[model samples]
Target chain A: MRNLADEIERFILRKLAGETNDITILQRNELADELSCAPSQISYVLSTRFTAERGFIVQSRRGSGGFVRIVRVPVQKIVYNKPDNIMDYCSPEDFENIIIKLNSERMITAREAGLIKYFLDVIDDYVNPVEKMRIFRSLLITLENNS
Target chain B: MRNLADEIERFILRKLAGETNDITILQRNELADELSCAPSQISYVLSTRFTAERGFIVQSRRGSGGFVRIVRVPVQKIVYNKPDNIMDYCSPEDFENIIIKLNSERMITAREAGLIKYFLDVIDDYVNPVEKMRIFRSLLITLENNS
Candidate 1:
């Protein structure tokens, strides 16, 4: 039997899959009621599985008309033209995260993502902070141009 | 007034420009005689101006029918799938040469090549030998995939 977290994640993914856009909105209490779990359980699943590193952005609204919004960030949307934004993504971890996110979103194939990650892993130690930023920028630009 | 070397270079370039292919074959003596220069001058221009690093491969066949063949290497031709070949092109100089050659060939725009070179230049000092190899392989694969 699958755990509650897995069930909730699958449920949310199914909702997103059925939608025309890469986004889905839900009422926390209603989702909890339908899943027969606590609202906190839904929050836990959202916070853990649907993260920015995993190519998802979850926005939780709290009020009388409260709802949760989940948006899947496109690979093209992450490309930054500004130098400061480019500098922000200068680490190997950041790059690997982007690759993983791209793979998960089906923007890039698993084989290509795996190969890119393999190279990223090997060169992490030698690539300095500045080089990492430049590489990340170049990669994003390449991807943007190709896309 | 243009020097003999400049004249010879331009003459050869114009000949190449007129041709349908990126390659041109010339009889050294005939070319020298036409340009009012010595055969050695043609040899000098071929050796110095048209080199592999400068994107031209000059093949000189000596005999009764001696001919100098200049072939412009396309950007797609430089992509290597073999591990050994990838390893051979691990140096910063090699990467820069590729960028220059690609730019000269109009395979990649000057701005794109410049951006790539700018990033490549800054990262050279920090990238280790193994890392350089990985980076080169990744870059080539990216270009190949995009192309």
Candidate 2:
């Protein structure tokens, strides 16, 4: 079911989509009033949806003269660095961030991201960490070539 | 290092690629002789590399008349059924299989599959099972619409 968070996300996304520089600034209180919701709701949506993994970085200043800044990360800034502890067993949250990063960078499509998440959710425990790392590294190399 | 197993996997993949029907059969002894490796080595490669998780299936007739049959699963026969215990924490192996199945069906590209695997490997533990399933189901719905 669509909720206030969904609506807020769509509204913000629409605003960003219409911008030429892939960025936008909003007055938080104004946005809240426009959306007919509380300012806290806007904060929640911004924090969750406008995350780095999702290709967005949101900066907001609190109080009467504050504004929110949403910037879509560009491709050139991506370093594609493998984590230092990549050889160890990766936690699910970290894996999710990678998926988000890929989608945000336009390295993969949304559907592809979804497909990846599905696999992550259902992956068997018996597939050991070493095998997982091997697969992950091989996959990154493949994307590096394609992207 | 290029090991016997890697060579054997390549040889079989090459053979499968060249087949018009996406299926192939070979005598284990003949393949071992041709590859100049032990038959046990061939068995290891077949069991590991040519697996359902990688979108492959092997049927072997044991004994003196042994033959290995490799068949690539087709798309139409996919049931897309969510497992009964989907709400529970998913293991790595099961997720790997889902990724493989998606790749095999051509619903996702090899690079995309790899990207998915990377995320699966690194996903954080804090992202609980319920949230994982929610994200996974949404992703599937998106793919269903796109595919």
Candidate 3:
């Protein structure tokens, strides 16, 4: 929260945390007003932080009633059981460790682990570190609950 | 046996081989005449060989002046070095088995395999199986060669 960029990222991440599938639909101008920063600053942060390499999919619409939606998609809510701080910023390795620990304790079967691992394998390709965590958590949760 | 399709396939592969990152482009009808075949045959080989799953990104333009561009993209070649049959229709398990064998043989380290496994974990989630294959193969190849 030191810099404006980090602040915006945090605001978005926090908003996404309480969402289903880790997706948050919001307007750029409203977010800029809330952050007391320029709208272009929001765009800058998003462009650099939320990227395909980082696992974020950002879409925008222009003109009246236009909006910007930042989505960390295909991720569901059950993966992160950590404290809010940790859950807000997690890693793929963090996910791997949790699943591995779960498997070791017999909380999940090997097949389930494989399925969870499969989810991890796919979402890990997303590049945004912050988004990577939420995406991993949500997908793991979905797969865990589904299976 | 020099099947026309195989001949056309080899001709394109050979042409791509001598280029940077192993990419090449050609006119469909022109290549057909060079191989003494129909334009549709060129499309067949490209549709098969230069697939996203097979580690290729093919972009083509239609109409009288249309051309097809076959880009090798960022993936290295060795990931596709399995037997022809294996390469033709490989699965996630096939890739996993290959990496495991390589690990056991110490051709790739546990760390390397882990890295490969990481890529495997993420790319597996791609909805398109063909894209999943190519993305995994290219990333794995890049990791293997770099490490």
> Which numbered prediction scores highest in DockQ against the true structure?
2
* Two-chain DockQ for each candidate model: 0.02, 0.17, 0.03
Q: Which wins on lDDT, candidate 2 or candidate 3?
A: 2
| TM-score of every candidate | 0.34, 0.34, 0.30
Expressed as tens digits, the lDDT of each residue in A1-147 for candidate 3 is: 369999999989998898865567788888899889999999999999987446666878765456777776322122333335355655557777777655543445453455456545556555566776655555544443533
- Per-residue lDDT tens digits for candidate 2, residues A55-105, read 676766665456888877753234234355354656678678867876764
For B3-45, candidate 2 gives per-residue lDDT tens digits of 5777788888889889998899998889999988788888888
Clashing pairs in 1: none
Docking verdict class for candidate 1: incorrect
Write the candidate numbers in order of decreasing DockQ.
2, 3, 1
With candidate 3 superimposed using the best TM-score fit, by how many Å does residue B82's alpha carbon deviate from the native? Answer: 28
TM-score, structure 1 vs. true: 0.34
Q: After superposition, how far is residue A94 of candidate 3 from its true place, in Å?
A: 36
The deviation in Å at residue A69 for candidate 2 is: 38
Residue B110 C-alpha lDDT in model 3? 51
Model 3 chain B worst lDDT run, 10 consecutive residues: B138-147
